[model samples]
Target: MSGIACAVGLLSSKCILSAQPQSAGRILLQYTAVRYRRKPRWLGTAKSKLFRVPERHQQVEEEVAELKRLHNVYHTQMKAVRRFLIDEVEASKLVSRAGMVIQTPEEEASEWEQIQRINEEWNRKIGEVREKRLADEREQRKNYILERLVAKEQRDQENRERVEERVRLEKELARNYITRDNIDKAIEMALVQPMSYNFSIDLSGNIRRLGEEQNQESSN
Candidate 1:
């Protein structure tokens, strides 16, 4: 095609109409009118010697329809791109928020380690208490057993001493009774002797001796 001509021959090719919507529309309309020639019906008539068919206005409905289809397609594509961009932004925000809320593996591991440490410390303390308690109980039992042994020894000694004392007392009583019976027999022999025999009594034993009587007879 030839370079598109303006409806007005005076219009310059350097003119640019991108300032406002109204100006851009006017320029586009003028450009369309010139590029697609609108022919009048009375250009060739029968009076002319060389008769020719007059030009008719070409229907540009198909071009307008094609432009509309392209416009709609481009608009839908741009809308899809904008929606995708918006969704991506929202997803990024949500990901950032989730990062703020959720704990990382390292942090969770550290927390679990702290809990284990506390539990281990408590277990150690409890073990110490239990061990100490058992030691005390063992000591108490040992002391009790020693005390019982000592008490038993003391009781056994006391019982033996009492038995010995009872035996000694019985022997002392028997000796005293035998001594009294001998003194009585000596006194009876002394009293049975005649007075002419000159016998003197030894009062210490309540009895008289034969030597005293013989000595008195020899003196007489």
Candidate 2:
């Protein structure tokens, strides 16, 4: 009877040891599941921050470029205005010298008529100069606007490219991070993040929509 009880106790202890391994494995699996659940949220936050940094950098670059372009335009306009003023002053001096050459009243009248004709011709020329300058200004404005638009488009495209690059890197990084058991789900989640906007029409539309939404919310 004593021998039988010892064997029974030994068998029961072996069964308990076997059961403990399964329990420990179950606990480990639960911990792994919890870690898996937490990883995506943390990874998403990290990637969001990464994307924001480039966007901010892009905005600053665009603003600086715009400021420099406007400064160049300002200097060009100032130079044009200065040249026009100098031409006017020179023409006035020529008119004064011609007036001094006239002597008798008749000659003076004839000279004055010639001066008048000259003045009229000069005035017409000045008017033409002014118009040309104005046209040049209009052309510069058109060109500036076009340049800004083109630059804006390029910046937007760069942003899109950066985003794509970031996304690709994020995937590569995720691949490096994931274990064999979790790779499929990680890949799927990575692919599911929405593509961002990076075009003129989309940017304009987004701004307009934001304004409208804000206005509507404010009215409420």
Q: Score each candidate by Cα lDDT.
A: 0.73, 0.72
For each candidate, what TM-score against the reference? 0.31, 0.27
Q: Which stretches of candidate 1 lie over 4 Å from their true place?
A: 1-101, 104-106, 173-220
At residue 16, give the lDDT of candidate 1: 37
Error of 1 at 93 (Å): 23
lDDT of 1 by residue, 1-220 (tens): 1122222332432333343346545533323212224323434322443566668977699998999999999999999999999999999999998888577999999999999999999999999999999999999999999999999999999999999899899988867564665988757766996355544566576455587667879999
**Residue 58: error of model 2 in Å?**
99
Give lDDT tens digits, candidate 2, residues 1-220.
2454444444444221122235545632222111121232322344335556553434688889999999999999999999999999999999999888548899879989999999999999999999999999999999999999999999999999999999999998886687989989878987997444432345446533455567879999
Looking at candidate 2, the ten consecutive residues that score lowest on lDDT are 28-37
